[model samples]
Target: MSLQTWLVSLFLLICVILCWSVSAQAFAPYPYDSYYSGARFRRGPLMGFDGEDTQLQQLMQNLKPRPTLLIRIASSLGCIAHIHMATAGEIVEVNWLAEHINDPHVKVLDATYEVKPKPNWEEFKNTSYGKFDELIKTHVNPNYTAEHIPNAVHFNLDVAYFPGQYERFSFYSPELFEQYVQKLGINKDDKLIVYSRGPAAGMLFAARVWWTFKVYGHRNIEVLNGGFNAWKSSGHPTESGDKSATQGNWKAGPIDKSLYANFDDLTNDPRGGNLFENKMSAINMLDARPGGQFNGSEPLGFPAPKATGSHIAGAKNVPLPNVVGETGVKDKSALEEALKKAGFDASKSTVTMCNSGVQASMLALGLARLGIKARVYNGSMSELALRASEYINSK
Candidate 1:
């Protein structure tokens, strides 16, 4: 790990031990749309690490993470996820998932989260099915009604992983997650393939769900590259049926900590905050918002008073609009070249932060597909903007 990362991890340990009593804020819920353009977000207190227990930590060690600046353990909801740095996972090619479309035992999950809220209720009930075929039949959107992934289960990454205020988008309670997986008839043995509508919206939902499985101890989950768009773009087959997939006896295992970000490292550590200031060298803060926003074109209600940072001093700007225009960032060669030409190291870690965590997820996903090491700063631009006040003056 870099010197900044080491110090941050150690400092985070101190923060968690000394201040482990605050409640976690709600995650930006799915159907995760409400991008209040000019919305300003403040960094909350440390998100905390559930390191009092070592069961999860052991699993993380098993992953054998390389010593890098991205290693962090995110703690929340009484559990800890050993979140590696951004751009770290095995990013399956956008078109790669389609190669195995004919596998019968391979189950596909459709994370269709709708906002069917009552008249004035700030919170709407989120209904996710373990099976996507059923959800397709109960189709709400005009686009999805046409066709859906066969034998796919409906996993609502939107509402299942919501926080308190953002309860609609926080992580699902362990009980709810297990019940949802079982309801979809997914067991430990079945390989799970997850897909969504588009790149940013859907792929992010897909990744969050993938992380969920790791938390629940399911090992064979994969995200369909480019989501439904990539499949259709390649003329892949699609089916619409209520054919329920059978569920195996899959017992929920302890959370594999590798998927979490250490709240301490994220908040209290010197490296965590210094990353905002390390724009000159050794660190790159990628902004996934449209160039308009990054260049100060205020869309919506953003450009917060504190969302100020030097774009990592010499950091290159890679707008999501360019990467995944219309469909998604499926072209691997193009993405790799983009980073190479931009002077980015695929093996080096990066922190993907967008308006919230969603767009960042897309960038992170794109980076991962190109084998670039990146991680989503789930706190969103709200957190980053707020944190930036310490460095740059937004006003």
Candidate 2:
């Protein structure tokens, strides 16, 4: 009764202890290297067998899980990193604006401008003087100023450039931009909501402002979907006269080079010949001009009155209207489908171009909302046609 029972009990206890030890090691967070499956580790002194270092193991254990909505961006070296993408929530709707209009932290900007026939001092003066006033009074509403959007300040695109260089749509100088920043009273933390007269107009004006703010390092900027026309059509009230903004402490931050492209960048490889023909280039040049303009069937406007029109050789034509509808930018699935049909590869880096930089910026913004990074060629065809005439001139 005593010896046989004691031997059997002792053996069972030993077997159970061994099984528990194996199971605990299998599920333990520290020892096993399987957790770093997709991660690539560099050879360093801190690395252990299978590249799992004690410090790294401790750090991983202490780190909290990433949010589901957060996107993980990998570096060129294939290391996981984090970056923010502009979401649909970043885009303000008319109803949201109506509710938040009076919020002190929310600043509204009316980015409306009439397309001038030519770039001359007289035209500029006339347009600036009573033309804008009449536009607000007549075209917009008698009770409102040409820059009407109810408690909104006007951001004149005309103010973006230095006085004499009217032909080129150059950004205002740093000093000038600083003054304009103060005039807008935008702080680092303030939320900016920009709108234009109509959808198409907003794409040109409001989106441009949105890009400018992003370039200057402002983070909380948004474009009003459907724009002011939608706002008015929704029967919202309008305000008359111009409203001035208080001085803000905002200063220009580092320019986001990824968001802009110039002629030199476009013409980097002389052997590549045309801007679009550079296969070695990382960027895909997208012509956002109208079909007629892209196909050389239309005339170049104003400044280059006699220059025949054509797109950069090898560029894919993706009309701006196709990406934007009556409301705002189309939904992601629709945009992806349209872009695919237009031969745009979302996987490749993209550079958007149009007659002027405005439409190009709109397309860039649209791409950004889709989590695709893009650059805008601000000079676009207007400057390109004049500079790279050999490439754009029709035979």
Q: What lDDT does each candidate get?
A: 0.52, 0.65
**Highest lDDT among the candidates is held by which one?**
2
lDDT of 1 at 103: 73
Candidate 1's residue-wise lDDT over 1-395, tens digit each? Answer: 97757986886566554333332112222211244223443333443323322433343344343322222323331222222322224345445556655676577777644444212113323334233334334444444445666556566543344332322244445665565567567766776787777546356667666655655777667666567776766776777644454655556776444333322344443443544344424445566766666565554243446434433344456777555645545477677666665567544557665555556656766776664556555655544444444433221
lDDT by residue for model 2 (58-163), tens: 5445433421212111111111111122323446788988998999888888888665433564555556432333333333322226447777877766665422
The per-prediction tally of clashing pairs is 47, 1
Give the residue spans of candidate 1 off by over 4 A. Answer: 1-104, 112-146, 166-168, 173-175, 199-204, 211-219, 233-237, 241-259, 262-264, 270-283, 300-316, 325-332, 340-348, 383-395
TM-score, prediction 2: 0.68
What is the lDDT, from 0 to 100, of the residue 312 in candidate 1? Answer: 33
